[model samples]
Target: MEPVKFNYEYSRKIRVGFIGCGAHAFRNVYPTFDYAPVDLVAVCDLNQERADIYKKRFGAEKAYTDYKEMLKREDLDAVFVVLNFDRNGHPLYPKIVPDILKAGIPAWIEKPVAYTAKEAEDLVELEEKTGQFVLVSNKRYFYPSFEKAKLILESDPFGKPVSVSGRYPLTLSPFQEELGKRTNLHWFLDICHPMSGIHYLMGEVKEMCFIEHQPSGNVQTLLSFKSGAVGNLELPSTQADTSPFERYEIIGNKQNVLIDNGMRLSYYKGSKGSGEYGKAPSYIGDDPTDGPVHWEPEFSLGQIYNKNLFLQGMVQSVNHFSNAVLNGRKIERATLKDSLHLTKIFEAYKNNRSGKWITIE
Candidate 1:
């Protein structure tokens, strides 16, 4: 059967059902429905009280304590699963995604899609068999600054990406043998952050080598992309609580771009001022406009740009998914293939030893 095509001008809103009513969904996901072309029909959660409260608050027509019952009764166009982790710190996406696909509806799942590579492969196979879409919500790829980076990298002005550097506050796990009983949950959860950025900027990784520091649990991974680009990822676990969480740099032949905290961006096309080492009166450039162009949202105004959903890329990603489902266009970012690549990175840390290079297929 052919996919449904929505009328861009006046088609009714696509009916969406949500599976998890957690704090994340309440703050980020449900709020986005107001801006997107979505009609939230139903919501499901393990806790009946929370489900009922979300249904009333978010305008969901029905709420159910059991997700299976909600899927059975509602003819939903799509489902969003923002569930928590299992006992092993594994995300519950692998267990729930298949059920959503079997119901003949597309789904958008929150990331760290799975704990292992095999689980991700299983989801990929299910997608192929059902011909249904499943998008992992990797919000960093959808951020405005990152989107601008994508354009710069793809455009002729930047030539080609030669190297990348990313900084994120993350904790590294112990060696695989010792990870069996470790209480460190950050390794499993935080791998997705840098992985999403790497996948978005550098494409799939061809090979990677990593080194971990024991005292601070800090890690640094060196990556080689399929495009022959090189990357360094640093996860510093001791960052200040009030400081921004991430920073990324993409270096090309004559151009370089930097994105700070997912919102601020700067592009350096070429060297601006040239002077002798000691003869230069000051390090300052010729004028205010001669060097790289910078972009950042103004925080003074009460606007969507200042909000976490918009600044962090959640809103755009959710909107894109809804539009694709409504308009019959294929999803461009956060595709199932992208999720598989991310899961591979997650598994690399889980199963492979530190300082070893793992190749992703």
Candidate 2:
């Protein structure tokens, strides 16, 4: 991939439209334009007051309560959508996205991409029919630390990536199936983080097994990958809110890398030689290549890497979709395809109980 270019450095900027003037877009998405190659032409939301506020705050020229009207009136290269749950606990994007594509504009939508794999498949089919693609902005997969982890896993020093593991704070009750997808919405949506990360890092999952804790509703899943790699996913709803919410590790042949809370990264190159654990004079390696190389953000500085927009991957995801639209290339990150895979993982959890190995075909 090419080094990223700042907004000012782009010779021509894409004229873009935005939907959803919610807390998430306000805090994360809208602020990313300072680093992305786009000129916001309009903002749209169901609430005209909120839409007008976003338009003024973000320097967009116009605002509208109806996105359909916005799409019809504005000549846009692409649209960025950030709406979350609907009244029924459904995601609004799937309902609105086909309309956007029907209008001939490409889109970048936030996850959860759809309520199930079937819905995602429908969206993909519409995307192909309209000749317009949608990028889901899965967020976690675009994190700088996690992006580098993918690179490391694909390289030689690690031999081959054999397994991956991730942890998140989420509650999924077995009775969610009884309540169906809408009432158990958060469980279906939040699983996107771990599922997207694993799919992006290790390729497709072939099959998986799960077990849940009765008290906390925490669940652990074991995944076998099509690539011959395996993975573990932990959903610990009782985990402390004071600490970081997510962590990950991938074990390569004789090496492994760990990521904590999307910031700290550690690459453990196994001990230089398999000597007795207690007999070594010093743990320091004789060669720098024998590495447990590490990385983490330094908040004291004003670096871009330290900002939440960068650290959480909002800016990077925006820039990526913008570049794809501007360059006439298909967007790969968080594509409808990735969303489909993630929805399958969601379905597996909803459909199966402890000890069942559900194959993802």
Candidate 3:
């Protein structure tokens, strides 16, 4: 791994303006600037007090009650938006990002970029027209475990991933009336975390079928990937909050990889039986090198990896956008195009009932 540079160590930094002085921004996004190449020049929010507080707290040069005024006055290379849902429970990104694009400033916005795929399509069109890109902050794609998993999947040993299983504690309202309204989809929109990781690891879903449980409202979604792999997504809504909430496994040819609780990963490369199946002396295999490879964070050390900012991928995603803006690199992760795919999944769940195979295209 390359050594990480602190913000001051960079030879240059992008002039960044921030919109939305919310709690998530304060806790997750703003702290990332300490490690990213960002010079936070200005902040904006509808709440004047919050904006002023954020500017002072985060070391921004100026604060504004209106984001448009900030864009108008500040010479910014990129902007970070971390807005919350409006009263209607709809994300504010699709409504706001077009104006930022028109201003010729790249944007890094928090996800569920839009309530529908159509809104995402509009953003894609606007990005093409304005020549400014938007990177949705879907941090699941940047998670350290998933990053390592990608390398393992691409290696020669783990040949042809054939199936996937994922679990996340997210509840979906089964009623068609509730699904139709974005206001009612707050939980579904904000809490659908596993889909992004699944997309990153397994590629796009060609078709999907889901079955809902009655009292619990839990769901199990079956996916057929365009790559010819199959998948099962388990959204066990009634799972206890205190319990380990998420787990994932990708099965390849005679080899399988598992991610537990989004942090621990185990790769079970094809293991040979101890001697023969009937009369084995021990369960342990003969070759030490053939044992399953395992990885988990060491909490004792005061290292960057242990920090939630790095662990949960907030800093990595921020650095990715900042570097892309600074170097004019084409962003491969969490692009608007990726957002379109995720939005299609959202639309599929909302529009169709359980047990039906919905085609995604």
| TM-score per model over all chains | 0.91, 0.94, 0.97
Candidate 2 per-residue lDDT over residues 1-361, each given as its tens digit: 3346677887878999999999988988998998888999999988888888999999999999888888888999999999978776777777899999999999999889887688899999999999999999898778998899988988888877889989988887664555553245465577888788878888999999988887578888899999999889988899888989798899988889898987898989856543577776666666757768899888898788888888888888988888888899998788998889888888877766678789997
Model 3 RMSD in Å is 1.6
**Number of the predicted model whose lDDT against the real structure is largest:** 3
User: Using TM-score as the measure, what is the rank order of every candidate, best first?
Assistant: 3, 2, 1
Instruction: State the displacement of the C-alpha of residue 44, model 1, in Å, after optimal TM-score superposition.
Output: 0.8
Note the Cα lDDT for every prediction shown.
0.83, 0.85, 0.88
Taking the tens digit of each residue's C-alpha lDDT, what string does model 1 give over 87-126?
7777899999999998888898888788777888898899
Give me the runs in candidate 3 sitting further than 4 Å from their true place.
1-3, 177-183
RMSD of model 2 against the true structure: 2.0
Report the lDDT tens digits of candidate 3 across residue range 147-210.
9998888788899889999998877775555545323677788543788999989999999999
All candidates: CA RMSD (Å): 3.7, 2.0, 1.6
Clashing residue pairs in candidate 3 are none
Candidate 1, residue 221: lDDT = 91
Give lDDT for model 3: 0.88
